[model samples]
Target: MTTAPPVHRSHTAGNPDLLPLLGRTPLARIQADLPHPHPGFWAKLECLSAGGMKARAAMSMLSGARRRGELRPGAPVVESTSGTMGIGLAFAGQALGHPVILVGDCELEPSMRQLLRTYGARLELVDRPAPRGGWQAARIARLREVLARTDDAYWPDQYNNPDNPAGYLSLAAELIGRLDHLDVLVCSVGTGGHSAGLVGPLRRRWPRLKVIGVDSVGSAIFGQPARPRLMRGLGSSIHPRNVRHEAFDEVHWVGAAEAVDACRRLARSSFVSGGWSTGAVALVSAWAAGAAPGAVVATVFPDGPHRYLGTVYDDDFCRAHGLTATAPATRPLEIPHPRAAEASGWTRCRTVVDPLAAPRGEAPAPHIPAPGGAV
Candidate 1:
C-alpha cells in the first residue's frame, strides 16, 4: 500500500510520487434481477480514488502540461466544469502546489461549490451560456477572460484536449487486468472522456467488444437537438468533440426518473452508485446483460452517494423534479443516430451526421414514429 499524502503536496500524475493516488480503482461485480445468465455485471468503483476517475484525467492533463512547459511553477490551474471534473482539478491543484480556479454556471450544486472551495480552488461563476455555445461556451469564455488576466493559468480543456482521454489509459489497463474478457462496455458520454478513453484500448484487446453508450435524453452527444439537461455529468447541450462516435455500437438515452430508479435499486441490490451518469450506465448495462446471453458487461461507476444525498437521494427534491419512481419513465430509447427521426426502443442510421451541420446536426433516419413525433 502506498503512503497517503497530505491534502497539499507537490506532485502530478507524471511524477512517480503521485501515481499511487490516481488510478487502479477496484472493479466490483454487480447482479441485477433483470435478465441474462452467468458472467454478470462488473463496474469499476471510481470513487475509491481521491476524486474519482476525473482526478486521473486531471493529473494526466496537468502533468502533460508541466512536461510541455505550459504550466509555470505554482501557477493557478483554471478550467470549466459542472462539478465532477472541477473537484478533480481542485484536488490536483492542491497536490501539485498550484492554485485552482473552476468556472461554471449557477446550476453548479452548492455541495460542489463548497467542496471546491474547501480544496482551495477559486470559483468563478458565469451568469449564463452564450447564444451559440450554451453553458459550456460561457464557461469557456470566462476561462479565456481569466487566462488573459493571469498569464500563468493552465487550462486543461477537458472537452477538446487529447490528454483528457489519455489520462484514462491507466484505468483501461486496470480494467483489463481485472476482467478475463469483456463483451459489452457500457459508459456515459459527457465530455466523452471516460468512454472514449476506456473503450479505445479495450477494443484493441477485446476485438469483439460491443461498446454501448449511455447518454441523457437531452444530450446532443448522440446528435439530438440541444435541450435542458436535468442530469449532470452524463448529458451535454453541446456535442463534445471528445465523443468518438465511431467507437459506439449502440446508444441509450435515459431520463431523470429512470436514472433515479436505477440508482436507488442499485444501491439496495448491487452497488451504491451515485451521480446521474452511473445510474444511466447501470441501467443500460443491466439491459445489455439481458440482451446478450453469457455476456460480461463492464461499466464505470464514477462516484459514490454523498454528493447526491440532497438531490437524487432526497425524496422531497425528487418530488420537485418529478423523479419519484419505482419504475422507469422510459426503458432504453435506443437510437441509430442521435438525431434520428423516431425511435421507441431500437434504431439504426446509415448517415448519423448531417451534411449541412456536418458534426452537430443529426439527419433524420426512419424507424419508429419519432416517439409520437416528440423528437
Candidate 2:
C-alpha cells in the first residue's frame, strides 16, 4: 500500500511566531494580598507576549516601521542588547523574513542566548570592559564596528531611536483604553525607553498622572558612580539620550536584595514570575498603592523570570550576592532629607531625585580625567 503523502506545516511556522501567535496580555485588577485604596490596581501582564515583554513591543515597532516604509524589505537588522530586546528583534526579524545580528556583552544570560539562536539571530559576543568601566563602552564599540562592516543592515538603536519609545506609546494607549483613570504609572528604567515613551502620551491624556522611574542602586542612570549591579534589564552605566527626565515625577533607587524579595512576593501572591526589573517596578507600585490610598497605580511587568533561572531565582545565587532575605517594607511617599537633597542633583517633589543622582549632574559628564588622574 502506498503511504499517504507527508503532511506539511504552514510556511509561517518555520520562524518564531509573531503577532498572529501572540495575544494581548490581560490587565488584572490585583486584589489578592496587594494593598491598594481603589479596591485594586491594574497590572499589565507583559510576560504573556510570545517572546515575553520585549518581543511584544519590539515586534510592533518593527512591523510598524516596515509598514511605514522606514525599513527596506529583506534588510538585515542589527542591535546591541544585554538580553530582552535582542530576543524581540530576533523574533520580529524572523517573522518579517529578515536576518538579525545581535551584539551582546558577555553578561548575557545563557537562556537569552539560546532563545536568540532559536529565533534564527546571529549572536556576536563582546568582551566585558575593565572593572569599574563596565560593558557599555565595549558593547557600543562592538556594535559600531559590526554596523560599519555589514551591508544593508539597519541598526534599531533602541537606546537612541525615537521608535523605541514610540513602541511603548502604543502600549500606553492600549492601557488608557482599559483603565478609566491611572493615578500613577511605575516602570523600571534601563535605556529609559519604556518610561519616557509612556509618560509623554499618558501625561497628555491625564495631566495629573505621576510617572515613577525605578532604578537599581548601582546603575549610573540615576546618578550613582559607575559600578557593577546585580539587577538586570533595568539601570544602565551610561546615560541614554532617550530618557526624558522631565516626564518622570519621581525616582526610586532599589537594591538587588529588595528587588529579588519583591520578585518572590509577586510570584507567591500573584503567580507572576518576573525578572529583577519587573520586581523592582512591582515593589514600587505596591508601595505607591499603599501610600496614595485612594489612587490607582499601574505598572509594567517587563519579562518573565525564566531567563534568570540561574541567578535571580536561585536561592544559592541570591545568598552568594548577599541578598538572602526580604527587605523592610516602606511606603513610596517621601519627605526629602537634607542629605538626600544635598547629594541628589534635581530637587522637585519630596520623592523626586535626579535620574543621574550621583555627584554627576542629570547628564553624564564626558568621560573626563580628574585632577589626580582618577575618573
Candidate 3:
C-alpha cells in the first residue's frame, strides 16, 4: 500500500506562521446576555498577539517584505509610532536580526517606552507638533529630517505605506471565516491603517458591510479642525493618506471621558484590558450594535491596558487632567446628551465641554483613578 508520506515536521515546532499570527485572535462575546437590544457584537482581541495590537500584523508584513526582497533583511529598520507599533516592529526587527530605531513624540507613555526598551529598540523623542500648522505635519517633518541624517535605515511609514493596509488583509479573511458574515466593522482611526486595511477585503466579500470609523473628538482626521485631545492612538491631528474614506459608511467621534468609562466597564465586567482607543471603539460598537438589530458587529482591540499605566490607569494623572477621582463605590457614568453629531456627519455622544471652544453643556463624567496609579 502506498503509505502516506513520512511526516516531516519543520524545525520551528509549535511556532506559528505569519498568517496564523495575523488572525484567530481571542474573540470575546463581551456583550452577550447583556440587556442591550442589538445584534451580537464581538471584539477580536488582537492585544493577545505575541507583540500586541498591530504589532503582529506589522511584523508579519515586514518579514514578508524582507522575504520578497522588498526590504533587505538585517537592514536597520526605523519607523515612528505612538506606542504599540514600535513594540511590534522591535520584536520583528530582533527576530529578523535587524537593528531597530524608533522616533516617538514626548506624549508617548512611559510604559510604552519601557516596552520598546525591553525589545531593544533605540528610542528618540521629538518635539510635539506645531500647534497651528498641525502636529502630524511637524512630526512627519521631524521623521523626514531624522531619516535624511540616518544611513541604511528603512522607514516603514505606517501612515502612508500601502503595506500598512496590505498587512491587514489576512485579518479580514480570518474575521470572515470566524463570523461567517459581518454586518458592521467598528474601528478607531489613527493612521487609518487598521480600518483601511480591513475594509478593502471585507468589502470584497460583504459588499454591504458597514465600516464605522471612530475618531477622538479633537482629532483632525476626517477633516475636523486640529485640537489637543486627551485620547491617544485613536485620532490624528491631520489627515492621513492611508485612511480609506470611501470604505467607511459612517464615522463617530468619541471623547476621552466616554472612552475611559468604556475601558473601566470592560475591565470590570469582562476582564478585558483594553487601551483608550479600543475603549472608545468598544463604546461605539456597543452603540452601533444596539442601534441596528441583527447586525454582527466586530471591532478591533488594538492594544492591551499595560501601556496606559501613567495616564488612563493612573489616579494622579487623571486628577491633573481634570478627570474624575477613582472611588471605591465608583460606577460607570452614563453619557449625557449622548447624541450630538459634529459637522462632519459623525456623532458625538458626550457633552461638549471644549476649553478651546465654549462649553456646550454639562461637564463630562467623573473619571475614577486607578488605585496605586501603577500599571
Candidate 4:
C-alpha cells in the first residue's frame, strides 16, 4: 500500500538535493491596494520553485513511486502536462536521477521549454488540441505511445492518482500554522489536484471553513458544459477524477477578460504576480471577503505573472483577444452568468453539482465513452 505522508507544519528537516527548492512557501495578506473592497484577504503564492505548487505534488508522487519499486532507477518517467506540472516533474526527475519526457502542445513558452531541456527532460510537442477531447487527450495519446516503446517508464497519473492530492498535506499544515484562523479557501480547479489536496486537510482543522472553487467559464469540471477555455493550468474540459465534487461548498466561473484584468491589478497593487488562477481566485476572494465581512479568507495562487507576460500582461495580446483593462468590469460582484457574457466579472453557482450530469458516485472520467473521454 502507498501510505500517506504525515503533514509537516514546518519545512522538511535535513533535506538532501533539490528538497530545499520545494517547500516553506510564504503566504501574503492583501489589503486596500486591491481594486475591490474587502475584509481580511490573503493569497498564497505557489511560485517559489520553477515548478510552483505542482512541485509539491511532484515530490509526493515521485517519492511514492520510488518506494513502491514501480519506478526503476534511471527509468524514463513520462507524463502529459500543460506547463507547471511538466516543469515540476523535470525538477523531481533530476533530483531522483531519472529521465523525464514531457508531452504537451507545441506552444509551450520558450523559457519553460528551455528549462525542461536544461533538466535533461525531453519535450514531445503534440501538433494540436484534439477537436473532441482537446490538447489533454492528444498529449495522453502521445504518452501512451511513448510508454509502449519504453519498458522502464513510470507515469505519475496526477489526475486520478491518490498520491496527487496526498502531496499537499504539507501545504495544508503550513497554512494551518501560518494563519491564526482561515475561514474561507478560494482555489482554482485544473486537474483538481491542489484544491482537493489542500482543502480536505484544511476543512478538517477548520471545520467551518468554506471552500469556494474558481474555474474557467468553459470548464466542464463544475457542472458547466465543456467549451474552449483560454486560461491554462486552471480549468479542465473533462472532469478530473481528482476533483472531490463534494469537497466544494460552491463554485465560481471566471472569464478570460476578467482574469487578465485581475492579473494586471494584482501586479500593480501588491507587486504580486499571481498567474492565471491568481486573478480568478483573487477576484472571488475579494468578493468572498466582501460578502462575509471580517471573515479571514485565503486563496492559492498557483504561479506568478512572468509566464503570462506575453499573454495576460501584454496589452497587445489583451487587445487582440478583446481582453483589456476597460473591457472587463473591475469590481467583483454577485453575478452568476452561465453563458459567459461580455462583462468580465465573477459568477457564483449555488448548485455545486450539475443537475443534468450523472451522480458523483457513478463512473469516473476515464471510464466515460469517446470523443469527450478524459485522461
Candidate 5:
C-alpha cells in the first residue's frame, strides 16, 4: 500500500504562516478505458494548493529576492502574467507583506481578474498584443512601464528566473516520497518552471526517468510559429530560457479543441480535472501510459477548473471558439523534428531542440533514449 507524503511548511525560509498553506497537494490516480486498456496515470492535484502550483514559485522567488536584498522589506512586487502566475504572486505578496501589482492582457478571464483583486493585487491589462510577441510581450512592456514609476518595486520575471524553477524542489520531494518507481513524467510547458525544476531531482533518483513536455498547438516553444492561442496555462509566444531543451525525451503539441475535450472527459470520468494546462498534460499522459504498457506515469494538474468556468466549461464560450467534445486521436502523429511540419492537432516529436540554438530545418541532435533504449 502507498502512503501520502508528510505535510510541512515550505522548504524556503519565507513567512512561516503562508508557506504551510502551499505544499502537500493530493496525488490522485486517473484510470480510463477509453480507446484501449492500460495502466492509469498519477496526477498531482496542484489545484488544491492555496493559490495554485505557481504559488510555490511565487513564494520562492520573493523569498530569494528578499534574502539577496533585491527586494527590500515592504517593497511592491510587479510582474506580467496570463492568469495563474498573477494569482500566485497575489497570494505570495499578501503572505510576505508586499503590495502586488500585475499586468495582464485583455484576453484574461473576468473570473481571474476579480479573484486577483480579491487577493489585494492591483491589476493592469494591456489592450492589444505586440507586433512580434503577442499578448505576453505586450504585458511585459506594460509591466516595465509600471516598474519604471513605482518606487522600490521588484519584478519576479517568472519566465527566466532561476528561483522560479528552484521553488518546485519540494514538489519533487513529495513525488519521490510517494512513488517508489516512475517511468514517464509528463508536464505542460508554460514558463518552464515546474518541469525544469522537478526533472533534475527526480532523475537523480530514477536516472532513466522519461520526461515528456506538452505544449499548445500554436506555441513557439517547440519551434512552432506563434499564432493566436486560446489556451492560457500552457504554451508561449516567446521562448523562455528556462525551458530545459535537453531534458525532455519527447514533446507533444495539443490543440484547444483537443484540450477542451480531454478536460470535460476527465471531469466526467475521474471527477478531478483542472484547467487548460491540466487538460493538455492529461491528454498526452494518457497516451504515454497506454503505449508503455505497465510503466508508471505521472503528471501535474496546474489549477482547479473554477477559474475556467467562463471559458473551458461554458457552452456558449465553446461554441464561439468552435470547440467541441470531439475526442482526440488515440495516438499522436509522430514527427522526425520539431519543424517537420506545423502541428495543428495532437502531434509528437522525438528530436527536441533549442530553437534559438538550431536554425530552422537544421538537423536536430540524436534522441535521448528512455529506459531499455526506447524513446
Candidate 6:
C-alpha cells in the first residue's frame, strides 16, 4: 500500500458557508404502526436542508432574476410568506448578496419571526386579514407597500412566478438518482411550486406516475370554501396561479388534529418528523402505500420540528385548539368532485378541477404585483 500524505487543520473551526449544503437531503423509510401498516413509504427529508425545501426555489428565483437583469446587484428582494418561504428567501438572499424583505401576518409563529430576523432579513407584519382574501391577501397588500418605497427592489412573487417551480427541477433529478422507480408522489399544496415543478420532469421517466396532492381542510385550492386556517406551510386562501390543477390525479384534505396525530406518531416511531405539511403528507402517503401493496409511494417533509415546538409539538397548544392525538381513519372519505361538498376532516376527491375555471368569483384571485417591473 502506498503511504498517505500528511493532513493539515485549518485555522478556522469550519467553513461558515451554508449555500453548498442546499440539496440532496436524506430519504427515510417511514412505516409507522399507528397510521397504516404497509411495506413503508419513502420520505424526502427536506427539513434537513438549510432552510427547508423552498430554499431551492428561493435560490433559483433570485439567481434567475439576476441573470435576466430583473434584479440589480445588492438590491432588495421582497415577497410575502407565512413562514417557510421567509426562511428560504432569507437564506438565498445571503447567498446571492441581496437583502430580503418579507411580509408576514400577525399570526406568524414567534420562533419563525426571530429566525428570519437572525438571518438578516427585514420583517413586516400585517395586522389583520383582508375582507375578500384573508391573511395571504393582507400580506401581499403590505408587500406592495414595502416594494413601492425601496429602490430597484425585485419581487420574486412566489405565488405566480414561473421561476418558483422551475427551481425544483434539481430536486426531481435528486429523486431519480436515488430511487430506481417511483409509482406515486404525495405533496402538500401551498403556493404549488414543488408539486407542479416536480411532476412534469418525473413523469418524463415514469410516464404513468400518479400525483397525490394534500391540502388543508379549509383551503380553497381544491374547491372547498375558504375558512380561517390554523395550519401553515400548506393550503392557501387565495388561488395561486402557480398551482397546476391538472397535475394532481387525486386530492386529499387533511385537518389540524389529524396532522398533529400523524406528526407525533412519526416522531415516536421513525424518529423523523416535521410540522403541519409533513404530517398531512405523511397521513396520505401511508394510505396510498396501503391502497396499492408494493407500490413505491414517496412524500416530502417540508420542514423540521424545531420551529413548531410552540404549536404542533406543544401539549397546551393542542389542547387550546381542540387538537388530539387520536389516529386518523385508515382510509379517507371519498367525493366524486372537488365541490361535491365542503370537506371538514380527512377527505379525498378523484376529480380535481381548477377552482378559478368554474366562475369569476368562485375562487379569490391573488393580489400579486405584475411581473417585468419594479414597484
User: What is the C-alpha local distance difference test score of each model?
Assistant: 0.74, 0.69, 0.67, 0.75, 0.85, 0.85
For model 2, what is the C-alpha lDDT against the true structure? 0.69
Candidate 1 collision pairs = 222-338, 336-347, 342-370
Q: Report the lDDT tens digits of candidate 5 across residue range 1-375.
A: 122122222323335587789979889998853334568999999999998999999999999999999988777888999889998898898788887888898898888899998987888888999999999999889888888777788999999999999999999999999999999999999999999999999999999999999999889998877888999979999989999989999999887777887788888888998788988888888889988889999999999889889888988999887776344555677778877777777778999988888765665333331111012
Off by over 4 Å in 6: 1-17, 325-327, 359-375
What does candidate 2's lDDT look like per residue over 265-348, in tens digits?
667777875888877777677767776788989988878878878887899998887676433333332325312322121121
- Each candidate's TM vs. the true structure? 0.86, 0.81, 0.78, 0.86, 0.91, 0.91
- Candidate closer to the true structure by lDDT (higher is better), 1 or 5: 5
Encode model 1's per-residue lDDT on 1-375: one tens digit a residue. Answer: 122222232344323455567767888888854322334689899988887879988988888998999987677788989899987887677667677878878988888889888877778888877887578878888889777776567888898888889889998999889888988898888898988799879999999998887777656676655666678888786767788888887777777776777788778777557778777787778777877778888999998887888878889999987666334443344444455544332233333342235553335544343222122
| Pairs in clash, predicted candidate 3 | 324-367, 326-368, 326-369
With a 3 Å backbone cut-off (N, CA, C), the pairs that clash in candidate 5 are none
Preferred candidate (TM-score higher): 4 or 6: 6
Q: Cα lDDT of model 1 overall?
A: 0.74
What's the TM for model 2? 0.81
Q: Candidate 4 lDDT, tens digit per residue, 122-183?
A: 88888888877788888888888877776678899888888898888888998999988989
Where model 2 places Cα greater than 4 Å from the true spot, the runs are 1-17, 31-40, 60-70, 130-133, 325-375
In candidate 2, position 5 carries an lDDT of 28
Q: Rank the candidates by TM-score, best first.
A: 5, 6, 1, 4, 2, 3
Task: Tell me model 3's lDDT, rounded to 2 decimals.
Answer: 0.67
- lDDT for model 6 comes to 0.85
lDDT of 3 by residue, 1-375 (tens): 122222221222222353344445778886732223345588988887766667655765676677678666456666777787887786666556667777788888777788798877877776667766455566667667666665556777888777777777767777878888889898888887888778888888888988887887667665445667777778887656788776776666766655676777777777885778877788778877877878888998888887877777776887786555432112122234323223211244333232233344645433333222221
